[model samples]
Target: MISDPDGTVLALFAAFCRIGGCIMVLPGFSSARISLQIRILLAVAVSMAMLPVLWDQIYPQVTGKGHSYLLLVTFETVIGVVFGLITRYYVLGLQFAGTVLTMMIGFNAPPTADVLEDTAENQLTNMISFAGLLILFLMDFHHVVFSALVDSYTSMPIGAKFDPQNVLITLTNTLSQTFFIMLRLASPYILYGLLFNIAVGFVNKLAPAIPIYFISTPYLIAGGMFLVYFGIAAMLKLFADGFGPILRGL
Candidate 1:
């Protein structure tokens, strides 16, 4: 019954190019553990739901541009990916912090399959990343992401020319901010590891024949575990709170 069904279809496809691209890299939604079909379906569902809300911004752009459809699709996907990666990179900061924490705290666990990605990761790293991501989910980070995507139409409209230099700057700034925030989150462990190692080193120097470093390994891990027990809740809380402001600022 719709008079311009072709136009509507084109608009929907254009919407998918952005929403689908965002979901393709979204943290919880885009996990390797999720089946490809499920991700695709989720993206499609989200795009369909978003179509009406974003119709004014998206529909007119694609309705009559048959020859430029490919170009529009490509740019829209790139814009979505850029936005998705903003959050993705922030989540990845937890992994980076975890890696540092494990090394500093002397927690040596064998590498295992990462819960989020297919790569192998230290058990401690996996635990931290999983916990952080789980907490973010509990905090409804995805809703915030979708909201931001909706707002992006105003900030980064469809068909906007892709500027590689600006894109590079944005990515670099996201990474820089992510790194600083991660450093702050993991600083306690870094300091703990440093002071503990320094004291252990002095002990080893005093008792060179006793393999004191090996002797202290158990204590080091025990202390780190204790710290995690008390601090993880606060750490994840900070991470979740920071996501919205930092991403919106970017």
Candidate 2:
């Protein structure tokens, strides 16, 4: 009855190494704000739980020689990281859109705190990041990570050998989609800002006498604030819609 405990344990450790590495970089689990210990513990728990169910399926496929477990382990890690990064890239789209929207509306205030580690980002950008993270949790996408992990095992088999070309293609495709989604989300703000700036420019051109520069800045800010307050609800809905597709695509 499989009495080779040492071999079995080694195989299990190898599998855990792959899973744990993936989780550390995974979207929901890999938050920059979260503690490292928590992340490691969570990965360990998940790997332990899934190992028995997955070992038979994954072990046979991964053929290799001694000490070169590094290659197999590396391949598994890359697969996991790629899967997680795809989802994260989309969420970053949400943040990028929010930053653009805020800049257009004149709310480009300096950031108050350290966001996503030591990076001091703009306030509006931070809000969108936080809000998007919150929404992801609210919608329970974290559970889907497990589903994605399972699918990865099937999509990229353990011993199938890593394909850098395909991985790069996938990442490039995801990044492109992220840029498109960000522009789409912030399109309304772009239009509003554009029109407002044009009108103000015309006024300044027409009446060179009235100190237009000083007065118009505040007016633009106020108008932008008003528009954003009303439109934020709609913007969030759009984010949710776009995020859903991106997650599914991943």
Candidate 3:
């Protein structure tokens, strides 16, 4: 059991380079609220658990590799980062959609701390972003990420030459897909705001003497809020449903 202690350690670290790299930028796990120590520990724990399953593949590639081991670490980390970014970018798409929704609905309240992160965001943006993330967690999205990570070892074996072009292509595709999905989610709000603003513009022209801008704002916001109340469930359901197919497609 103790014959190849050094090799075991090396293999474990190799595994960590990938898993830890993914967790380093993963959405919920990488939030500023999560302490650094906890992230490291979780990465190490997962790496250890994975090493046993991947020992035949990882242990062989790492053992006796000497100077080349350093290069392996770098490539492994990069691949993991690509995997993590895929999911991170998708979640960020939701945040972008939230911002658009807030602006469209005229809910331009003072920005406050984001519920999931330290950044300041409009209250409506914060609510939509947080709600979307919560729904993903409830749907066990992390499990999907982990499953993909496991499959990656087979598709992208350790010590394989890193392909930056392929990585770029994957990320570009993810962003493209994420943008379309988020656009669909926010489309209703977009239309509401567009139509509402046009009507308000005409009313302002008709009552040029009155402060129509001030008068119409409350109605604009109220109508937007009503739309959100009635539509949020369907919006999040579509968001959650889309996550699986997108990640699996990758």
Candidate 4:
């Protein structure tokens, strides 16, 4: 039923190069828990579904003679990877916040497997990262990511030359913006930790014989937990809200 099935297949492969590459690094999809074969199949399925919609744009490009299809594949994959990393960095920023929060709150639980990845990290950090990722899933951040990938064809198009300068600038901006967002979210706990430690130090100074540091451990954990109980909802809300603006800005 199809005319030029070969061209169609080539176009599909081209689409896959980008979509599959993006999925390989995108947060939820890229989790180590997701088998690589499953991700590959999902990418192929998505590429097929998108093929009809992108047919006109991709078909012409793929059908052209004398163009190195291999080169195109490499470039498209790079572009996809770059796009994926942009979203990935935002999520990684949450992990940074988690680490900072865990350290500040003194939740020095033994290291455990990360819920999202196979790597070991402090238990509290793992918990916070998982919770933040779960919230992002509930909000359908993946939908936004794929939508933006679709639009990227218009802005970046197929076969656009890779710009290291732009890539560097984008990454720098993302890091800076994400850092500020993380800082703001964790600022309350940071202040709480600082003041709590300072006060404990003062008490220890006043009563040199008393083991104030030992005495303060339970209170430190309790106060941090209380702050988290009150502030976690807002923290995640702010974090999820920032994702859109950051992606759009890039």
Candidate 5:
């Protein structure tokens, strides 16, 4: 039996619309700093590539109910956005951690206009965020993202009812996890900073005549830089080990 060309195109386009809009806002890929032309190209590339795999699964489920189709497409877009948001949380975790670290490190740069969100993250954020992305790449975590996109069609069916409560719960849980992971990942620096501050404070108290401010600033700066430098392997290792589990959780 031959399918109606219009119906097939509609189904195909509906699926494409969701996937295209998703990759546009998807973390790592989503950046206004990147040219619109490039984003469109990426959207098209991902949309076309995903269509074949997802179409058979999603097409049958699409009822093609006149204007109801727009509602369905909107739901699809929401699902896509939710998926991107959930998956993007890990990147946001790094940014959050970087933001806190920037404050500690005295790098109070404004969040860029092209940033993914209104995070008050600083210039060191650029470093930490880039480092996080780089670590994700090195750990091959994008494979998990691609696999999750394919898996999402089956997990979240077309025209399925979404629970707003569950969405809120998921977001809350994700933010909590992000903050925890940020502290965990940067524990080395946090530990160093804490101990250094305590010790320096004591030394100043014991030696009231000495300007520990002059003495301690260079030590903390040098020590913090040293720890951050030596800590790359640990950070990347954490990324490698945790990313698969995080993707699976998402």
Candidate 6:
């Protein structure tokens, strides 16, 4: 019943180069906790599902293309990785923000195994990162990424010349925007840390004989924790809100 099975296979692989590339570095899906087999199956399934809709676009470009087909695969995979990096960078920004918050609040608990990855991370950082990621999933952020991928075919079609300059510019802009957003989220804590340390310094000066550093640490951590309890909702909301504009800018 199937016609041109060879061409169909070529087209499917071409599509996989892009979609699978994205999934390879995608946030939740790319976690170290996920087995490689699962990621491969996921990429293949998504490639197949998207193939029908993209048949007219992908099939013609790949079928019977000789050596040029290899070029197409390379460019396609690069484009996919670029798209995945955009989202990945944004999520990593949240992790950076979490680390900043932890230090600011004086929450120097020993680093523990990260909930989502094999790396060790502060408990506070892990909580903030996981919570931000969970909120994004709840809000269906993957759907947005997939939509962007579908739209990318229109913008950067198969066999199109790869533009490293544009890719660099896009990534640079993403980092700039992510840094600004994360800074805003962590600013209050930064301020808290600065002021808290200053006050403690003054107290230590006043009571030189007292173990002021030892006495003040618990209060510093408690105050920071209180701020986190009150401000975490807003922080996550801001983080989630920034994801859309960043992706759309791409």
**What TM-score fits each model?**
0.95, 0.91, 0.97, 0.95, 0.84, 0.97
Summarize candidate 2's per-residue lDDT along 161-235 as a digit string, tens digits: 789999898889888878987788799889988998898889999998988877888887888778878877787
**lDDT per residue as tens, model 3, 60-177:** 9999898999999999999999989998998999999989999999999999988778789888878887788888889888888888898999999999888899999999999999
Clashing pairs in 3: none
True-structure RMSD for candidate 1? 1.4
Question: Tens digit of lDDT per residue, candidate 1, span 1-250?
Answer: 8788998999998989888998899888889999999999998999999998998998888877878889999988988888788888998999999999899889878899988889999998898899888888888888878888899888888877778788788888889888998999999999999999999999988989999987899999999999988998898888877776667643
Measured on C-alpha atoms, candidate 1 has an lDDT of 0.88
Candidate 4 local lDDT, 52-82, one digit each (tens): 8888778888887446888989888987887
lDDT at 128 for candidate 6? 94
- Compose the digit string of candidate 5's lDDT tens values, residues 213-245: 787777777776676778767875775566565
Which candidate do you rate higher for lDDT, 1 or 6? 6
Model 5 misplaced stretches (Cα beyond 4 Å): 1-3, 105-123
Q: Which 10 residues in a row give candidate 1 its minimum summed lDDT?
A: 241-250
**Clashes, model 3:** 0
- Model 6 residue 83 CA deviation (Å) reads 0.7
Residue 167 alpha-carbon offset, candidate 2, angstroms: 0.8
Superposition TM-score, candidate 3 onto the true structure: 0.97
Root-mean-square deviation per candidate? 1.4, 2.1, 1.0, 1.4, 3.1, 1.0
